[model samples]
Target: MHFLSTYQRIISRLLLVSSLIVTGAMADEVIMPPAVANTASNNVPTVGPSRPKNIIIMIGDGMGPAYTTAYRYYKDNPDTEEIEQTVFDRLLVGMASTYPASVSGYVTDSAASATALSTGVKSYNGAIAVDTEKRPLTTLMEKAKALGLSTGVAVTSQVNHATPAAFLAHNESRSNYIDIAEAYLTSDADVILGGGQQYFTPTLLEQFSAKGYQHISEFSELASVTTPKVLGLFADVQLPWAINDKQAHKLSHMTQKALDLLSQNEQGFVLLVEGSLIDWAGHSNDIATAMGEMDEFASAIEVVEQFVRQSKDTLMVVTADHNTGGLSVGAHDKYEWHPEVLHKVKASPDVIATRAIAEDNWQPLTATLLGFTPNEAQYSQLQSARMQGNEPLSIALRKLIDIQSNTGWTSGGHTAMDVQVFAEGPGARLFSGHQDNIDIAIKMFSLLPQSVQTP
Candidate 1:
């Protein structure tokens, strides 16, 4: 429990620091205990060179300052317009950098960025966690296992997607789902969680009873498993977001279970958690959806905090690969129906999925929740799209914005600008400067005991 007490003190320190800063007070530090916080006086310690016993990298896909700020604002102020300290603000470290391999006035896709962070080397866009020749490189996960430590990867994305796939599977192309699935079977990562169940299921949808690998498809089935090498593919693909929940799979549940199973190994572990839908909502330019995704991630962070604050040697690096959609909070409230009307809509954003339930029902649903009288012209457009079996949340959101406020920018793609990184733990001091995505691997290994270092 020594580690637990130290971690709790660190979290409390962070909370105290943030609360102070939010109140317009500036303090040099919140003063955590010697074991929990990294002070300049204790840069080089006797704790095996500040190596971490456990590591967690949380990725908020396509989440940059704009998206993060908007979420923080709404979360801190759901009422008046007073935003609180950002999650980054409470971290021991913060920095930013680009996602691409070079500065050619270009932007990067998820694949290149994922490879860069996983392999400690940058590659062209669309490449998996491999170099130009397609040669497989050792990732942080692979290295951790090589040193007799356990590793795990969890995300809200399909397990075969670029981000999660980077940690385990290595191939020339990130789009090769079949190849990625094959790689997962041989990875050293002990606890694999999240979607892409169909990739392994043959035409007959076989179970672990018929395979060389252990597998589970339902949350209950997952919670009941006890095997060392377990893969919980909870959905055929990306599980529905919390708002929809048609599939009823819980992302936080999967993450918690992975942490519990991996932490039992005394050799230590490294885990990755991602809220992949933040990017999806960004692509659709939908604030309501993005806000909900952020809320879900916030809850997940709370879960990690409980465990993180218990382990003195664990480190948490929460970051985003890149920014999407140039999103900005509206500068003015264009809707004039009255504060009470807007309050109702904000209070029950759940009315959205209810809007999505039927053929032509979404129009009235959005109109009602938006505090606007139903407009025949707009309803006609929505009805036509629904008649053609299309449900572009973007259209409804655009209409909502048109009625409520002026949307400042537009996009469905990544920004050339850099993304932020936030770190918490003993040696988090290694994270303060602007850095390449590739440095993440090197810095982490530097924090680990020499026995755990890869050649």
Candidate 2:
């Protein structure tokens, strides 16, 4: 009897592994409708097209550990009205390292990390795309522009925020909003989209106009400008979230529209699309807002996927700069699954006053507070401290507690945790195993022709 029981347990373990492998591979198959076929020209040099005609880099600015896991629950849950497609799904591979040059630490601010990702070098936090001496660093966009390629940047946050500004702005300080706005004029980035119109007032507006940039403030005006070069800024700062700002317009619409206009140049173009608020959601500890941001981020990914499918030469890279909130997951099983938990996570306004909260470790307090608490199976473990006590920040978040059913966090912060990177196209195969964040810039630049290697 003992022998038979041991044999059965071994079989169960193998079957579970097999199931996971199959599910993972199957989920990785993200089919882009045929519209993506011509994203890069098929007929190319025998040596291969040295440069992609179009490059779309999608960044989830504040998406750290907590955000990733929380969204996974939403996607895995069949009860939701909208299906979530995380950019990670497209990843043929992954990595967990996002360290800066100065040292190894748990939390590296977005400004420093983004600067490294954008310019291929690291600097202290709060520095834009500049080196330690406060000198400007030439970014990939600058290199592309030097080679006559067009460029554009789009974000859901203030255009000059740490993530988006890192691509084009080179300032001693990332906080120099006014100067960062002015730098856009010199970028030669033919296309510029997103908010922060407030930065481009009459004085700055005149500068762009003088440089011969066709600038517009409204979506309708965008169509009329009809210039080979276009610069569109819709809001004074970051555009409103799709949920909170539906009265405004859609992010995917802006992304698709930017691609439409930028693709006009046969010389090729590079565009950066960011879902900045996923990070904000982590900071606020607002689960619903975070899910909303993930859905929006997915729409932007669909746009890139569509583009990638059309163009064989185009390499679409989707990744987060770092993981925020140390996001993690509960062990998956029948014991923790609950549909009512989804609506339960709302963060406290006090979160802003402080960056870390130990009690919000992701277990669905909503389930506990609602009296649905864990089943007898889970309670046995909790009683032993395998799980912590249930603690909900507020009634809003409490409702979601039952759904997530997870708990464990050192603090509310970005982990030195390695972020995931997904790539698809001709040279995408080069991405595998672990690599430095700066390696992304190096690998991408290597594919460019010699003349553009240094710009």
Candidate 3:
């Protein structure tokens, strides 16, 4: 009888150990800490029946829930017992579907998704601030302007890029950069800060100056210019990835500048700030670049949080236009995550690609960037690709890194996954629960002061 009892105990103990291992493996796939609950009873504050005097909408381009999760783990090093809370974690209101019009299929592009968020209407892919039929639609910024409030846009990408362009420029196609730049002359946004200096030629600069707009390129010029109507073109095209250029004009600095100028308007302001390169990083499948961009974005949110505390009447909403890369945290081994390995990465794939293509060698560059020598198979594949000279070096490097890190990506394009939405201050309650992307714009319009609600 004693022997039988002992055997049963041993079996029970073994079963428990097996279960624990399974649970640990599952947990490793999603290294993010359990969400800090933001229930209405505890998390949300009591704001009475008052309309917000100002609205600031921040878009984390291509920032899906997975990106947020990956960033949280990356920033906090989730392997530790203590983890820090990200700004988005504290303010998470709800999730929003990112599907566009049926004609555009299930996965919405940046242009279509941004238009939906800006104008409360579903539009085909590639359409910018226009309906499916290519008709111009009034945007939240335009409405805010009509209501006598100042408006502005700040982004990490070119100002004429799809996401930012959807907010202020109406075009049949998002690729029409020249047309988009021309629209800015009539946009009358109080402040415009970003790259795309090439889009605004010398002639356009003179035209802007004639219309009481101060155009500046250098960061110093942007800082010193006190003019309310300012145009800051910081780079010839899209700004360098955050990881590549730390000293360049950062998104947080640009946000602060835009706020400074827009606040000068007594009638309040509506600003759209986008962490545009988060999408690009995802597209490149570069985890290091994504982390750098997310860190900058979090810094910008911190600035906005400070602004919200002081103003008390500002409605701040943060969301993503779409999910890019379909990035998954872990792949080969369910019980493993290697966020720390990302620290070893020093340069973006683009930089490495440029060098590798120039030198006609990939092994040395890959070793330097990844902090390890490539294996026999990787070296052979790279050599063959170089011999062929058809595949992009960046693409080849990204594939190699993806395998090395055990990171998984569905494609080099956007995904139809629902993205996170976080809101704080007046009318934040409207943002809770599952919602369509268009619902955000509708709710914002509804919350506008009654006097300025009309077109």
lDDT of each prediction vs. the true structure? 0.66, 0.62, 0.80
What TM-score, computed on C-alpha atoms, does each candidate reach?
Answer: 0.79, 0.71, 0.85
Quality of model 3 by C-alpha lDDT: 0.80
Task: Highest TM-score: give the candidate number.
Answer: 3
- What is the clash count of model 3? 0
lDDT head-to-head 2 vs 3, winner: 3
Error of 1 at 351 (Å): 10
Counted clashes in each candidate structure: 1, 32, 0
Candidate 1, clashing residue pairs?
51-447
How would you encode candidate 1's per-residue C-alpha lDDT over 297-340 as one tens digit per residue? Answer: 76676677667778877888887888888876664544322222
Candidate 2 lDDT at 267 equals 69
Give one digit per residue, the lDDT tens place, for model 2 in 283-317.
54555556667778877777778878887657777
**lDDT-superior candidate, 1 or 2:** 1
Candidate 3, residues 9-97: lDDT per residue as tens digits?
A: 33443333222222333212211111111212332233233467899999999999988988877788556798788898999989999
Residue 192, model 2: Cα distance from true site in angstroms: 1.5
| Candidate 1, superposed: residue stretches over 4 Å from native | 1-49, 78-82, 103-105, 203-213, 246-249, 331-363, 368-377, 392-394, 398-406, 452-455
